[model samples]
Every structure is written in structure tokens, then in C-alpha cells.
Target: MLGGLHFWFEIRIFMHFIKKRRNKPLYKKFLPLRKNVQNRNKLLWFRKKKWQKFQRAFSRLKKKKLHDPKSYFLSTFKNFFSRKFKYNLQNKQRLSLFYGGFRKKYLKRVVKSTLKEFKSLNKHVTVLFIEKLETRLDTALYRTHFSYSFKNARQLISHKKVYVNNKVVQHNSYLLKKGDVITLDKDVFNFVILNILDSEMWPIPPKHFYVNYKTLQILVIEDIHYTNCLMYYPFWIDFNSFLKFYER
Candidate 1:
């Protein structure tokens, strides 16, 4: 009788599961589920790519600050708190408070004082401070096609495929002035500039700039030492040494 009762309970549970599964459509129960998994995996990949991009951009900003400590720190703090206060409030009332027409008046006073100090430094200091940063790696990544990650930009440069103004530059720290030109290796040629030109779902390109498909050229930097070395020893050296070694 005990064994019979157990068998009946098992049958009941199996029926319940069948009922539950039956409520879902056949397509969802089978094929759609696989497609859902595939979509999820694709999303995960894009998220990872975005995260790596953010990390690289942040690191590049940090390096710029280190290069010019006083200006960088002052600008950073000013931007940080200023943006924080701006976002902290809302609408016209928020704007009034930020601009000193509101009760606190403290925010307006701070802003004015900061501006005054900034102006006292130089007549064009404010303009310079607000100007967009033009880091070498950023220029390369923006102009020529290179690595997807900022950290990867430095690595790509080390590979000796990145050129700035007709010179093969391998330093991410190299700051760029206006009118700089960047080129990529033939291997990464398509990677640097391939854009989606379709009406399909995945329409967004990996980066901000548009790719000129017709003008795109595949030209690898041939007879390169680092490329050969890396091909042979993928995991043999540290990143810094590897950069220096290939720099030769």
C-alpha cells in the first residue's frame, strides 16, 4: 500500500508538470527557448564589450589627469560636483537654485566663485578647461580603426600598426593635437571600420563613428617583428615588457 501511494504521488507530480508546460506554446517550449538563449548570449557579449570600453575610457581620463595634475584635478572636481548638483535638482526651481535665484543662493555663490578663480588663472582658462580632451589613443580609436577596448588600444599600438601623422606610434599616452591621422594593420582593417548597413535588428555599430565601406582598404603592416613574435609567443611575456620588446 505504501509503494502504491508513492507511485500515485509521482504520477500526480508528473501530471502537474505536464499541465504547466502545456500552458506554454509549443514554439516557446522548444525552438523559441533556444533562440531566447542565443539572444541572451548576444546581449551578454555586447554588455561585456561596453564594460571594457568604459574601463578603457576611464583609464585614459585618469592618465590625462596624472599628466597635468593641477589642471586635471581642478577640472575634475569642478565637473564632478557641478554635474552632481545639476542632476540633484529638477526643473526651473532646480535651475534657480543652481543659478542663485533660489533660497539657498549658496550654489550660485559657489559657481560664481569657482568661475572667478578659473578666470583669474588666465583669460582663456575657462575655454581651455571646457574644451574636449584629445588623447592620442582616443584620436587613433576615433579616426583610424583599432582595438575595441581602450586598454586594447595601447596593446594595438604596441603591435606597431598604429600610426600618427605618418609615424608609427605605439604609446597610448601620446597626446594628439588637431589634424592627426591614424591607420590600422590589414588584419584589423575590417575590425576598425566595419559598420552595419542593414535594417536588421542589430543595426548599431560597435563605435560612434560611421564606417566608409567603399573607401575602406585592407593594408597590413608587413614584415613586423612584434606580429611574428606574438604569433609564436602569445603568453610568454608581461604586457609592459611585451610593449617595450615590440617597440624595437
Candidate 2:
């Protein structure tokens, strides 16, 4: 009877777990994330639960350090299975995608063209690649603080809410050029301005662009190289690994 009761209780707990996770956003569903808050700019903190998720994970880690036999064994098991030791290539690919929503093929093209462009200039490959990546319209929007996250900027562009040079352009991968102008619908643009006006975020307005807060306009004054793309690029990314990924 005790064994049957224990099995019944376990089934009830499993059902509760399923119900609890039903409404969680897609982001919180990812597990075992050890990234710092600053490194996860793509996370939109729409709810307090987003922050609490990290807190809970950290609390779990703290419990593992208490030296209990079961805790030590569990921690050892996790460390044995965790792939952080082999994540160098994964980190490089993530860096390329984190700032912008471009895919592997697009990233390959960016790397290829950036290498060709560097033939005439004396610059590091990764730095030049970062400069080129920043030329994306969505990256500029996120850097300018017009959007909350890189994913948010891509959503706005894909929804046809962003305008380039007074024309509606839905492609998030559209590479920006010098003399190009960016605008958005008046209501949404004003709302964003108000949201960001009093905020102080990292990697302040890039030096390569001009933003007219009053007129809701963005002008690209300079091209790659002159831009401060490194400010937002994650420092942990292995540029050498990224180069190898693209070279292949």
C-alpha cells in the first residue's frame, strides 16, 4: 500500500509540473543557462518571472555547494553532462546570431564578403566582420535603443513597421548603406522615443549614425570600420572559431 501511494503521489506531482509550465514563455523554457544578465540582451524582461528564472537556477547551484552527498553526486553528474567545455564553436555561431537574427548562410556570406573587403585594408578579420554585421538595419535599431532587443527589432522590420529611406522594407537582413534614412510609423516611433528617453543603456548611440529624436529619423553618416560595433559584441566569442566556421 505504501509503494502504491508513493507512485500515485509522483503522478500527481508530474501533472502539477506540466500545468505549471503551460504558460511559461518560450525564453524561460531553456534550461541550464549560465550567461550573465548583461550578456543576454535578447531577453525581454516583460515579466518578473523572467528574472526569477535565473534566480532559481542560481539558488539550485547554491544548494549543490552545501556538501551533502546527494547534492555532490548531482552536481558531478551535471558537470559531466554539461557541454560548456566543448561550446567554443557554438559560442562563435551564437555571437554572429545574437546581435542580429541572420541565419548560417547569411552569416557565411557576411564573412565571405568581409574577408574580400579586408584585402585592401589592414584590419583584423573579426573586427571587420563585426563592423559589417553592424551594418544591418535591425542591429542599428537595437544599438540606437529604438528597440528593446535584437529580436524585437527584427519583429518590427518583418511586420513592415520599419521604413528605410521613406520606403517600407520588411527584410531584416537588408544591409544599410551610407546616406540611407530610417523612419517608422509616427505613433510607434513616438512611443519608443518616450520609452528610451530617460534610459541609460550600454553602448551609447553609435558614432557612425545621426538620430533626430525630434523628427524620428536615423541617418547613416559613416560605413563599416568607423562604427563602434565591438561595444555590443559579446567579448567571449571566439573570433578564430568564427573564421574557421565561415572558411569551411
Candidate 3:
């Protein structure tokens, strides 16, 4: 029951952030649920992936069964959302938000922004768009194994422990640019070294970041230009469809 509550709390926060991206401040401390949080098992998150998957799949399957699609399970195996291309666009938008940690408004904004910046899609703007997301502080931290999870990375940033270019930036959405250097507060840096550095989480940091475990620092090497960014998630979503989702 406690594990269930924690999982829901995280989902709630994610959904809330997307809905009120700029309108509202986050309720990091909850008056109503503070009691539950106080007793939460810190280790429960280690198994959270399995737990979340089970709950989400079971609930979604139950709903699908109740709705009774025309083709039933066939619809799932092959384009369950719809046969139309529009469904692909929607799915890509959703997956990009869910996996990339983008808000709805921000997701569309990113799409439009990238379109204008590149001035066309011929530059493989989809890859560039994904590159932007990966450069976000929280996502970069998670990728580099600086933090155990995205939420953890966000918490560290919000606590003013993470620094970029020698300045503390609380927003996890802060974008890292080429030549920007990242470091953590001394106490937090030592703590990370004591725990995370030796954890074999990611044995090798990707080439795009110059990580010095000894210095407790990370430097943006060059803007990564990898198309395989989408492969990071277990599921499939087409970036091309995401691009098409925008009005041509």
C-alpha cells in the first residue's frame, strides 16, 4: 500500500507539472499526504519500475477489456490506438512527454521552436529536438549516472546542490550548452562520490559529456547528434510522426 502511494505521488507530480508548467508552483510538501511520505520506504523506489509496470498494465488492460474494441487484442498487437496517422502523432507527443519529461505546452512549444530554428525538417530537426531534451539538466544527470533517477536529479537541483557554470540553477529544465561545466555542492558532491560513483550504474558516461569522477564534474563535449536517442526507451514512437503532428 505504501509503495502504491509513492508511485501515485510521483505520477501526480509529473502530470501536475505538465498541466501547470508555468501557472502554478509545485506543492513539494503536501499537507494531506505528508504523513504517508514520512513513513515511506526509501528503498521502495529500487523496485518501482516493476511495481509501476504491473499496476499500469493491469489497469489499462482492464479498461481495454471493458471498452471492448472492435478487433480486441488484435488492435493492440497492431496499431491499437488507430489505423490513422493522426494517432501516431498523438502517441509520439505522449511518449515524448512521458519519456522526455516534457509538459504538453512545452512539448508543442519545443516542436514549434525547433521547426523555426532549423527553418525546415531537412536538417533532421527531430534529432535536434531530442538533443535539446537530452541536454536538460535532469535528463543529463540521469544519463550520466550522476543521479539514480530523473526525480532524484530534479530534487537535487531544486535543493540547490547542482551547479552549472559555477552557478546554482534550481530548475531541472535548465538547458546545458556546449562548454558549460556542471558541479555539485561540496557536501552533495562527496555524498554522490561515496554512494553513486562506485555503483556501476552506468559504467561509462557517453562520449558527449566529459565526466571527471575525480573532480566531480561534467562538461558538455559537443552537441550529440545521435538518431538512436529514441531507442533509450523500451517502447517505440516515431519522431517523424511527431514532426508531422505539427501543421505543415
Work out the TM-score per prediction: 0.31, 0.65, 0.61
Q: Over the stretch 24-60, how does candidate 2's per-residue lDDT look in tens digits?
A: 5534433333333234434433346647765555444
- Name every residue pair that clashes in candidate 1: 186-220
The CA lDDT of each predicted structure is: 0.37, 0.66, 0.61
Each prediction's RMSD to truth = 21.9, 9.5, 12.5
lDDT (Cα, tens digit) per residue for candidate 1, span 1-248:
99999999999999999997775422222121111211112222334553454333333333223223122111122576674433333222322221113243433443444356665655332222112112335433523334343445566678887766568787655655544445556676665554212112221222223334454422222221232222211111222321222222
Q: Across residues 1-248, which tens digit of lDDT does each residue of candidate 3 receive?
A: 99999999999999988997654222222121111111122322335554553333333333223222121121232564465554554454445433434566777787888888777555667777887677889877876777765777888899999989989899887889999999989878766775565455433455678888788889998877664454443333467777667534
TM-score of 3: 0.61
Model 3 clashing residue pairs (backbone): none
* Candidate 3 Cα errors over 4 Å, as ranges: 1-81, 85-90, 93-101, 120-122, 194-204, 227-231, 246-248
Candidates 1 and 3 compared: the better one by TM-score is 3
Clashes of each: 1, 0, 0
Q: Please report, as a residue range, the 10-residue window in candidate 2 with the lowest summed lDDT.
A: 66-75
In candidate 2, how many Å is residue 137 off?
A: 0.6
Q: Best by TM-score, which number?
A: 2
